[model samples]
Target: MKHVVFLSAISLLCTLLVSADTVTNPPHVVQFTIDPATTHQQIDNFSASDGWSMQFIGKWPQHKQEQMADWLFSTENNTKGQPKGIGLSLWRFNIGAGSSEQGDASQIGSVWTRSECFLSADGTYDWTKQAGQRHFMQLAKKRGVDQFLGFILSAPVHWTQNGLATNTGRGATFNLKAQHYHDFARFMADVVEGIERTEGIRFNYISPFNEPDGHWNWVGPKQEGTAATNAEIARTVRLTGQEFARRNIDTRILVTESFDYNCMYRTHPYVRADRGYQIQSFFTRDSSLTYIGDVPNVPRLMAAHSYWTNTPLTDLKKIRQEMGEVLRAHRVRFWQTEVCIMNNDTEIGGGGGFDRSMKTALYVARIMHHDLVYANASAWQWWRSVATGDYKDGLILATPDETLVDGQFTDSKLMWTIGNFSRFIRPGAMRIHVTGRNNDPESATNQEGLMVSAYRNTDNSIVVVVINYSTDEQKIRMNLHRPRITFQPYLTDDVKGNDLKPIRTVQSGSVTSIPPRSVITFVAAQ
Candidate 1:
C-alpha cells in the first residue's frame, strides 16, 4: 500500500502523538519544536563550534602511513554523510617545548608525547623537529579550516630559574624568576613568529598555559608539567603580547585555560591565598591582576577547560548565566578551550574503546548544547583530536601500523553525530532561540535523558535537534502558534530498518515518535 499527501495544506495539524507511557508516571513526552520568526527565548548568541586536532601523528607506524591521514585528509566519502575531514572549523596545533630533545625519563614514551613546556640548558628552540605538527597545519590549511589555534603545555626549562618546567613551590613560585618574564615571553613570541617564517602560515591565537588551577606531580623524571597562578598567567600574557607587538607579529592570545569555570570565577588557593586578586578581577581596572591594563581590550579570550564541572545541566546553566553577565559587562568573549576524560566512566565509551562510543557522542552533543546555548562560548576544542588508545574517546583511531581499527575508521557513529552539527551549522552562524518544556533542557537530558539544541542557518532555514536520553521509546509532538510553512524532520536513531537508518527525514508537521536514546535533527526548510 502507498499513501501520498500534498506538500501544501491549508492547516497542518498533527494529533495523538504516542509517547512513552510509564505505569507509575507515564513519561510525558515533552513537546519541543520551534517558531524561528517570533520566539524570543534566544539565550546566548554563540553556540561554540566543535572539532578535533592532533599533536602526535608521527608516533604512528610507517606502514600505516596516511592511515589516520587518509581519514582526516583523504577525499573519499566513507559511511558517514560528509567527507573524511570536511566538518571541522578549527585545528589546534599542540606545540612542543623540546621535551623530545631530552633522553631518559624526560622523554615521554608510548602514544602521547608529553613533554615539558620549554627547552633547557642549551637554549635550543628549533622549528625543524616539529615536522608532525607542521604537516597537520598544512593539511588543515588544505582542508580550508577557518582558524588555527595553538596551545602549549609549558615554557622551556632554560628560561626558568628553578631548573624545573612548572611553577610549583612555596608561595606560587615558578622556574622563571621575577626578572626573567621578558625572556620567557620573547621565547613564546619567537616560536609563533618562527612557525610563520618557516611554515608560511600565521597562527591566529595562542594559549600559553593549560589548566593552571590543578596541582600535579611531574617530578622525578616521570612527567613534565608546572603549576602557574592566575596573577602569573596575566603577567605572562602582558609581556608576551608586548613582545609580539614589538616584532610586529599579529598572533593573538587567549588567557588562562583554567580547569573549569570555578577556577575562573571562584576564589581559590592561587587566587585568594597565594595571590590577593580574584581571577575575574583581572578584567577590571581596579584589581591587582589588572597589571595587563584593560584585559577586555586584549586579543586574549577568557578560556577554561570543561572538566569535573560540566556534568549537571542545571548547575551548568546557572554558571553560564552568571558568566554571561560578567562577560557582557567586560565585553570579552569566552571559550571552552581544553577538556578530556582522564577519569573512568565520565566519558562515554572512554573506559577502553580506542574509538568514540555512543555514550561519548551523546555526552559531547549535550556538552556542546550547553556551551553554546548557556555559556555562549565562542569556540570548543576537544582535549585531543586523535589518540591510538583502546579508549573510545577519540573522533577517529589509527594504529601505529596505519591500519584502520577493526571497525570503519572513517565513518564511526561518533563522527556522524559530530558531523550532524559541525557540517550543517558552520562557523560565524549566529545562534537563534528555540524553547522547550524542560527547565534546563541541556541538564534534563544528557546520556541519560533528553537534550535539544536549535540554530538558524544563513539561508533562513531553522534546525532543531532533539536527543532522547532514556532507554525507552519516546513520542514527541511539536506545536506551532502562527504556522507558516511546513517542517521537515530527520531522525537518527538505533533503529534497524532503512526507514529508521541513521537519518530518517520526514516532511510532515504531525506528531512523530522517536526511538530510545536517539538523536534527531529537524530542519524546517521553508
Candidate 2:
C-alpha cells in the first residue's frame, strides 16, 4: 500500500509539470549584476546617431513651429538637461535631393514630405530653407553637443545621368564617371561651404555615400546608386578630401558606408545575399588603387554599416575577430557607424506589441555588444532618430494623428534601451572590457532567445542589460570573479516596463531574477 501511494504522487507531479507548460504564462528568471573592477571599456557618452526625424521638429502645426523650435532649441526650455547635457552627443544631417517636390515619384512612399533645402529652385545653397535644421543644430550645439556629421543620399537631379535621382536605363544603377567624380566632389564641397557660409556650422565628418552598393531602389523609395566598387569609394574620398583642402573646409570624408564588413572587404562574391555585386577586391592590399590618392587614408574614417550579416552575439564576435585581423594588417580606423532594426529574424510579428517588441530592444543591445565588445568601434550610428513607419525600424515611433503636434510621438522601449547607454554613458568615454559572455547556457540549446549587452560608464559605473525573448521569465547568474564589491541594479522589463517617472531598482550581489519577455538594465555604480 505504501509503494502504491508513492507511485500515485509521482504520477500527479508529472501531470502538473506538463500542465504548467500549457498555461497562459510560464515561469522565468531574468537578472543581471555588475563588476566595475573587471571593466575593459569606458563609455564616452550615449549617442542617438540618427538624423532630424525628430519628434516635434517638423510635425507641429505651422503656427506652433516657432514655439516648438524655441522649446527644442532653447537651453532654458530643456527641462531634462538630457537633450542638452549628457544627452545626444552626435548628430547626422540627411541632405535630401528635393524629393518631396517630386510628389508621388519621390519613391519614399507617402510616409514623409521631403524637407526643403536651404537653397531652393536656384540650385544655390539657401540656409533659410533649412531653418528647422539650423534651429536644431544651434540647439544641439548649445546643449554641449559639438560633434556633427552629414550624409547625402543622392546628388542633385541635374547632376545625375538619368536626369532623375533614381537609377538609369538597362536597370543597372549609374556610377559617376571618373571625370564626374570631381563634379560630385565639388557638389559635396559646395554643400559644406553653404552650411558654413550660410548656416555658420562646420561638419567634422561627411559620409558622401550611403549604402553605396545597396541594390534597393525607389523614387521616394529605397535607392540603388550606380553601384561604385571599393576602389571608386577610395578615389572619391581622395578627391573629396582634396576639394575640402582646396576650399579650406576642414570637414573630413568618411568613406564606404558599406552594408557590412564582409561585404565591404571580404573576398567572396555575394550571390544570394541582399547585395549581389563584388566590391571587396578593392579594399585588398593587392588592389591597383592601394594608395588612396598620393596620401594614405585621405578619408579619415573607414565606415561600415552593421547590417544583416551578424545577428547573434557569438557570430558578431567571430566576425569581429576576423575584422580585427584584416583591419590591423591594413592599419585603418574602423567605425560601425550605421545600423537599424530592419534586419532581424522576425521582420514583423502577428502580435500587436511585436512592432515595438523586446525583439527590437534586444537587437539594438546585441548589435551594440558586437560593435563594442568585439569590434571596438570608435563610433556607432543608429539609422534614424525617430521614424514614421514600422518597416524602417525607427528608434522613436510617431503616432498616426497628424493633428497631434506633428501627430504624436511615442518613446519606444528601444529608445529607452538606447537611453540606457546614451543617457548615462557620455561621448568621449572609452569602452571598458567586461568579463562575461552575452549568451546564456541555453542560448545555444534554444537557438533563438535571450540576448545581453553590457557597458562600463566613464565614472566607473557598470551597466549590464539583459533581454528576455522567451515566452516565460528568465533567471540569470553572473559571477564577477571579484573578491568583493558593492553594487546596484536598474531594470526595465514587462512587469516594470520602461517607466520614465521612476525606473525600478534592485540590490546587487547574489542571484538576480528578471521578468518574462522583458529587458533589464543592471548598473553597478562605483
How well does each candidate superpose onto the true structure, as a TM-score?
0.78, 0.74
Tens digits of lDDT, candidate 1, 49-96: 112223345433433435554443343445753244324667677666
**Scored by Cα lDDT, where does model 1 land?**
0.55
State which candidate has the highest lDDT: 1
Model 2 scores worst on lDDT over the 10 consecutive residues at 14-23
Off by over 4 Å in 1: 1-29, 33-86, 105-111, 115-125, 162-172, 217-222, 268-279, 291-297, 312-318, 344-355, 401-412, 438-447, 478-502, 524-526
User: Model 2: per-residue lDDT, tens digit, 1-526?
Assistant: 0011222222222210000111134444333222233333334333443353542354455544434323222223134322321255677777655555566564545425344444345656655564555655665675566777877766655566554444545243434544577877887888788787766678777887776665453112334234554556667777777888877777877766776677644543542232322233334445556345243325423677887656554566677767755654555556777776543544333213424545666556656656665665666667766566655456656554654346655555665555555555555554432222252222221213555555544554555555555666555554443333333444444333442212334432344555565555555554
lDDT of each: 0.55, 0.52
Which regions of candidate 2 deviate over 4 angstroms?
Answer: 1-86, 104-123, 168-179, 197-200, 217-226, 267-286, 293-300, 310-317, 347-354, 400-405, 436-454, 468-488, 500-511, 524-526
